[model samples]
Target: MDANSPTSQYASLAAHCASAFALPVARALPEQPAAVTAPWCLTVLAADIETAQLEQLAAFVSADQWRPVALDILAARADCKVVRIQLEGDIAFAAARLALLELGQSLGVELVLQAGETQRAPKLACFDMDSTLIQAEVIDELAKIAGVGDQVAEITLSAMRGELDFQQSFRKRMGLLKGFTEASLAEIAPRIPIMPGAQRLLLALRALGCKSAILSGGFTYFANYLRDNHLAVDFVHANQLEFDGGALTGNVIDPIVDGARKALLLQEIAKALDLSLDQVIAVGDGANDLPMLSLGALGIAFHAKPKVRAEAPQAIDGFGLDAALYLFGLNDRAIAALLDERT
Candidate 1:
C-alpha cells in the first residue's frame, strides 16, 4: 500500500491487509458484442484493496479484451468495500466465473459476476434453516442428548453433501431420537447459534421491502422459534416432529419438507406475496437446498459443501450472510443506512 494512494486510510484500518494484483482475466476474448445494449457487471466485495491493485484488476479486464466502460466505488469503508466494474464484450459466463473464483481466493474477497440486469432488489428472500439461518443442525443437538450424536452427525454430513438421499437419511436419524424428551429439545433450541450476520441481514432485507421466509428440512420447533424471534421473518415451513407423552415419537409428520417440498413452499410464498421467481433470492448450504436454490433469480449456496457450491448458480463462502447485500446491488454505505434506519 503506497502512502499516497487514495485507499491508504483503508490500508491502515485493515491490519496486515495484503496488496493483491492478479495476472489477468485468463481467458481468450470471447468476441465483440454482437447486439448487446447492456454491459455485464462484476461486483467485487472485499475487506481491503489498495489503489494500485484496483488499477491492476481494471487492466486485467482490459487485457481480456473486454472494454471496462465504467467503474464505481459502491462503498469505501476501511473494513469493507464493494467495487463494480461494467464491461462491454461477450465474455463467457464460465470463463468470467472461473476468473471471479480465482480472484477471490487470491485476494481474500468475494465476487459476483452476472449480466448487468436491473433486478428489483429481491422482493422475496427464502432461506434454509439448519446451517443456513443458524450454525447448528437442530437434530444433531437433540441426538447429542439422546447419546447418538456421532451416528447422527455422520448421516447428516452425508445427506448434506448429497451422498445420501435426504428423506432416507432423515428418517434414520429421527429414529435415534425415540427417547429424547420435549423438555430436552426445548432447552437446546434457545441456545442454537444464529449464523453470523443473520439478524442484520434479515433486518436489512425487510427494510429493503423483501419478505423473508425459512424453508427448512429441519423440524418446526426451531424454525418457528427463529421466525418468532426475528420480526422481519414473514413465514416459516419445516418438517413437523410428532411427539407423545412429553417425549419424541421419532417420526416426522407427512409432507416432509424435503428438497421438492422446499421448492414448492418457495413458489407458494412468492405467489402469496404477489411476486415472481425473478424477484426472489434463495440461499442455503446443502443438497436439499438445490431444488429451491435453482428457482430464484439469485440462488446462492452460502458457505456450503463442495457439491452444493458447485451446483448452485452462485456461491459465497468468502463473507458472512450479509455479503448477500452486495449481490443485490447494495453498497456498504447503503446497507449501513438501511440497517441503521431499522434501529
Candidate 2:
C-alpha cells in the first residue's frame, strides 16, 4: 500500500498510535528503505487495546497488512491490560510487530518477545555436601588428621573438575583418610562452616513446604551432622567409609554414590516426592554435582567453579546462599518477612 497516498488506510494506523509515541509509528519507516522483511504475526499489548477491540482493528486493516498474533496478560501486573498479540502469515506483519514489541518493552510496557520459560515451581532442593553446603571437604579434613592432606586435596580438585572419575577419586582420597579416629568425625562436624547463608536458605525452603536433600561425593559422617543441626535434609547419599575395629579399612562400601549415582538419587527423590521435573531445584559447585544440577528445573551454580558456572543457567556469585531466594521472585522485604514469621 502507498502510505503517502491521502486515502491510504496505513496512514490511519500511524496517526492512531502517534500520541502514544509522540511520533507516527508505521509498518515501514521512511529511513530504512532497504531492510529485508520476512512474514510474521503481530501481537498487541496494552490496557487501551482491550477497550478498542484490537481484533476488530486487525480486521479493518487489509488481510495482507497485518494479522492477529496472540493475547496474553502482562507479566507480573495487576490490571487486565491487553498483552502481546502475535501476528502470522505475512513477512511485513512480522517485521512490523518485532519492531513495535521491541520498542514497547524498552518503554516498560511489560512486553516480552521471544522469551523462554523463566520460572519453575520447586518441591525439593538438592545440594552437594562438600565445598557446597559446607566449606570444608570431609575427605580432606580426614586426610589432614592422617597427615596426607596436601596429597588428597590435589586429587580432590582434579576429580571435582570431571577429569578423574568420582569413584576413582574417592577411592584414592579415602585411602589417605585411613586410620583416622571416629572421634575425628565428631570433631570436624561442628567445625565445618556452612557456606554463607546456608542455614537461612534451607530454613526458607522448609518454610515453603519444600523438602531438601544432600547427594554428596563426600562421606556420610558430616551429612549426618547437617541433619542433626535442625536442617530439614530429607536424604543423604554418599560414600560409606569401610570401618573395622574402630579404624578406617582403607576401602569404601560397595556401590559408591559418585557423580552418576548422584544423578540417579535426584531422579529417585523427585519421583518419591511425586514432584514433576520442573519442580526441583539443584545447587552445587563441583563436577560431580553437574549431572543432577543440569536435570533440575532450577539448576544453580552456587559460588561455583568456572566450569559449573558456565554450564548453569542461573548463577549466584556475589550474594550469600540465601540470595538464591530471589529466583522465586521474592525481594529482600518479602524474604525478611518470611524469616520474621519463623522467629
Candidate 3:
C-alpha cells in the first residue's frame, strides 16, 4: 500500500492522536485511497462481512462528511472474524454506532466503537455475578429449594429489568428462601453453572495483568464459590445471607451490594491500585449493574436485559463473554497467545 494511501495510515495516526485533529479546508481523496487515520474506531465482529458492504457504509460516511480510512483485520476463526475501520472526523456518538446497524444486521455482524485514546486493554475489570459469570441467579435456585421459586424468580426478573427497587426486591426474594436448609444451599454452590467462555476470558485477562473483580448484587455465598472454584477473579463483593440453626434466616448482613454500592467499590479498588477509572471495565446484565457500568471507562452489557442494552455504552448479545476480547482489539491470535501464557 502506498504511504499516502488512506488504507496505509491508521497505526501512525492513532499514535499521534494528541496532535492530529480534523483536516482543514475540506480535504478530499482520490477514487481509491489506501489506509487512513481516525481517533474513533469501529470494531466489526461476525461470521463474515464483505468489504463491499463495509465500503457501502464508508461511502455513506463520506456522504455524511466523515472520512473512513482503513479497514484492518484483527482476528479470525472458522466461523467468525473481527475487523476494524479507522475513522477521522468526529461524528456524534450515536451516529457512529448506528452507521452499521442496518447494514450490520443484514450482514450478521455486531459493531462496537470507542475513542482511540481509551482503546487499550483495561487493567481492571468488574463483573456482575448472577446471569453474567454464572447462568443461574442464586436466589432463584434457593427459592426453588424452599418451594417458592415462582415468587422469587418474579421479583428477580423485575429487579433486573429496572422495575422494582433492587434492595427491596432482594430482601423479598431472600425472605422467600428463609426456610431453606444449610445443606441445600451448600449443595447449590457446587452445581452452579458457569457462563460459557467465562474461565477462558478470565484466564486471558489475567495473562494481560488485568485484575478481575466480581461485584454482585447476589449473595456472597455464590460469588465466593465462583471466585474460588471457577474464574480467575481477584476480588469479590456481594450481599451476605444470614443463616441460623442451619436454615436461612431470610435476613442479610448490612451493606447490600446494590448498584450504588457497586459503583463505590469500583472506585475504591481503582484508587487503592493507583489506576484511573478510565482504565476500568465493568460488565453486567441487569438494572442494578448500571451504576458501576456507568463508572468504568468501558461498560459492556453482556447478553443483558433490554433496558441495560439500551442504556449501556456498549453491548454484545451475539456471542459469549469472550467476545469482549475483540472490544479490546485482541484478535484470535492475540487471545490464543494470551491464553497460552496464562497459568
lDDT of 2 by residue, 78-151 (tens): 22122223334444423443454444444433222221222322688999888778877777777877889899
Stretches of candidate 1 off by over 4 Å are 1-38, 51-56, 157-163, 341-343
Per-candidate TM-scores read: 0.83, 0.65, 0.83
TM-score: model 3 vs. ground truth: 0.83
**All candidates in order of lDDT, best leading:** 1, 3, 2
Model 2 is weakest, by summed lDDT over 10 consecutive residues, at 71-80
Could you list the CA RMSD of all candidates, in the order they appear? 6.7, 14.3, 7.8
Q: Which consecutive 10 residues in model 1 have the weakest lDDT in total?
A: 25-34
lDDT of prediction 3:
0.74
Compared with the true structure, what per-residue lDDT tens digits does model 1 show for residues 1-343? 6754435543342322222222222121112112223558777777776555565666667788877655445554556666666677878876777676776666666767766663337899999989988998788778887889999999978875678788889898988899788898778878889998899899988898889999998988888888887536888899888889999888768788899999999999999889888888899998889999889888889999777876777788856788787667665556767877521
- Least well predicted 10-residue stretch by lDDT in candidate 3: 24-33
**Whole-model lDDT values for every prediction:** 0.74, 0.61, 0.74
What overall lDDT, based on C-alpha atoms, would model 1 receive against the true structure? 0.74
Cα lDDT of model 3 by residue, 172-260, tens digit? 88787776887887887998889988998899889889999999988888888888888999999999878899988888788889899
